[model samples]
Target: MKLIRGLQNLQRAGIDSASGCVLTIGNFDGVHRGHQALLTRAVELAERYGVPATVLSFEPTPREYFSGERAPARVSNLCTKLLDLGSFGIGQVVLHRFGSAFAQLEATVFVRDVLASQLGVRAIVIGDDFRFGARRAGDLEMLRREGARLGFEVDGIASVCAEGLRCSSTALRDALAVPDLTHCEALLGRPYRLVGRVRGGLRLGRTLGMPTANVNLRRQPALRLGVYAVEARALNSDGTGGEFLPGVANLGVRPTLGLTRCLLETHLIDHSEDLYGRLLEVRFRQFLRPEQRFDDLSALSAQMQRDKSDAAAFFASKSTGPA
Candidate 1:
């Protein structure tokens, strides 16, 4: 999928303003089931109109811009969000940086100048409760009126529900906070995953004989701080094709080591290979234990061994099937 960095680059990217496209706009944080429903409709409309299916989203998301430290923990970062969008058949993504000036844009101006004029959007698919523009004045009704006047179509999708719970980023975050992988899977229509590039660490895990692939996390994640049974895969430079390997992972701030920065450290079971700089996707399978500060390195190392054993057992059970 083509990624257009901003509105200023849309014309440079050669998108024909006259031809137009079917579009959906949102943060699309987790790209959960609800988002999938909207995207599916957008794709359908794109096919019918013979236009590209495009997604208009924001970087740093609006909440992150306005709320700062108080913003909700992200379910997926930009890299993961884009990967999910492409997997769901998105043809192009227009990622805008959210800042003070953009936040103050009026509702009418946003519809006319941004959506209609800049994007050449032929049709829009968004949630019924979506709000936009200066002080959040834009609503479905306003969007419909603008679409009518501007000669475009607007489709408002009701909230999608899964297992009687609304499939939303908020609900997905709640499930992750509980470390309930099953419910999260239902909400996302897939396992909740953390994706990042393997980076060099202080080699503490190596000293402990665990030798982990450390993935730096930029945004605070909604996932509970804990050790988990997981499966990981190293993607190619193009972000495709990798064989998943069973592993144990810790998603935490490393309080025992007095480190405050959050990190994802994974150790592949019975496997050893260099993973530095490769993009890795870690999928949580089962929560094992909450992160804790052990009294000493000995205790921490012992716990790490037990965590690995538990993860190995979990994978074994899955391979063996129900007794």
Candidate 2:
């Protein structure tokens, strides 16, 4: 699983050795089941054509560029996307920057330069309604025309659905709006996850005998403010086996404590170790309850105990202990 951060970094390697590949292109925000179908088509095409399976996605995601603002709540971050793509047997990924220069490229320039010249794409796969390039004017027909001119082939995948509704990132985001992990999993093909660096917090959890590692969101989304039942993975300080921690997390401003900045505080059940300045990936398995403002520290402490008990029951049912 090679991670090519930028086009400049990729081109600096002299030449891309991958002569032929079955490639799919998209924003792939959540890499939802619909995106999976396209990737699956790419894999199948690669197997049949004896070429590497490749994915071409954009950084800063096109939406961020078009929106002229920070991205909305991301379903998966860069690290998580790389891992998820690797799990599907994708060998190569080209992450192009979606800056003004690239975004302004015409539909044909993108096809000729990125698809034909760099990737040496033997075949291209995309969703039926896929579009790209300057103001997102490129469509399936445009790709087909470019494929003919560039001597590559194009395949369009139809929508993938579950329980009647089409599986889509928008649908997944809506499901997450209500903190519905079960439905999110069905749409995402995995748990919805957030990746962040563990940073220092107020240590209020420490005072309550439930020390927590804080994960700060780089780009905050409108996630339902609440206490959540989560399955978290903490990286070992020595970089050995990653530890999985069943825990409860509070995602909100600590109203009772009168903190203004939003925080993610997770108290691991039966685990204690310093995680300051480490990277942690937290995967939300389910929503437990909404955050509440207690009248006093003692009231807050009492609620924390109940949250732990609920977390314990949730983990016990799964039969997987802390990793």
Candidate 3:
């Protein structure tokens, strides 16, 4: 899959208005089951029309741009979102910057200039409740009307449901806040995972005999602050192909260490090699405990040992299967 960073780059890449594509536009946060349904339909339409299956996503997202620090926790970052899109067989991604100027664009102007002219969107797929444009003035009806005028097709997929619950990013976040890994898996059609590049930390884990690969989370995450039994893997350069290693991870602002920023610190139980700078994916298997402040390093170390043991047991249970 190819990634076009901006609207301007589309022309440079020869995917201008003439080279029409079937597109799905959204934040696509988590790329959960509902998003997958839309993507599946988009790909089908693209194949029918013999055009590229394209995704038009935004940076910072519309909510993040408008809400700033008050924006809802993000289910996935840009990198993970792109990875999910590619995995779904999307042929191209046009990542547009969401700022004041773009946010102020009128509904008709967005359809004409951005979708029709800039993207050459031959077919568009969106959720039934999808809305866009200045103050979200556009809806399914508006999009269909625009598509009719512009000589393109528009389709809206109904909301997908898991166990009668609507499978949506908001629902996924609520499940994660409950720290319900099982429910999250149901909603996502897989495990809830975080992917990030390993970065250097203060070596506190190392000093305590539990060295960790720290992944910095740039945005607020949908996951609850807690320790979890996790499976982690170092991804290849293309963000695929890696054997998962069982581990225990802490996802939180380290209150004990007086840290203010959130981080995902995973310690592989039995395998330890340098992981700095490598893209790592950590899948949460079970919630262990909520993050808490510890009195000292010794107390924290003891709890860490128990967390490792619990994670090992969880993996063992999985391997042994139901009795």
lDDT of 1 by residue, 1-323 (tens): 99999888988998856868999999998999999999999999999999999999997789989999888999877788888998888999999999898999999999999899988999999999999999999999999999999999999999999999988999989999997999999999899988898999999999999999999888669999999999998986556856789899999999999999999999999889999989998889999999999999999999999999999899888965211
RMSD of 1: 1.9
Report the number of clashing residue pairs per model.
0, 1, 0
Better of 2 and 3 by TM-score: 3
- The models' CA-based lDDT, in order, is 0.91, 0.79, 0.90
Candidate 2 lDDT trough over 10 residues, lowest sum: 234-243
All candidates: TM-score: 0.95, 0.85, 0.95
Give the TM-score (vs. native) of candidate 1.
0.95
Per-residue CA lDDT of model 3 for 92-194, tens digit only, reads 9999898899999999999999899998898999999999999899999999999999999999999999989999999988988987889999999989888
Error of 2 at 287 (Å): 1.5
Runs in model 3 deviating more than 4 A are 320-323
- Name the candidate that leads on lDDT: 1
Q: Report clash pairs, candidate 1.
A: none
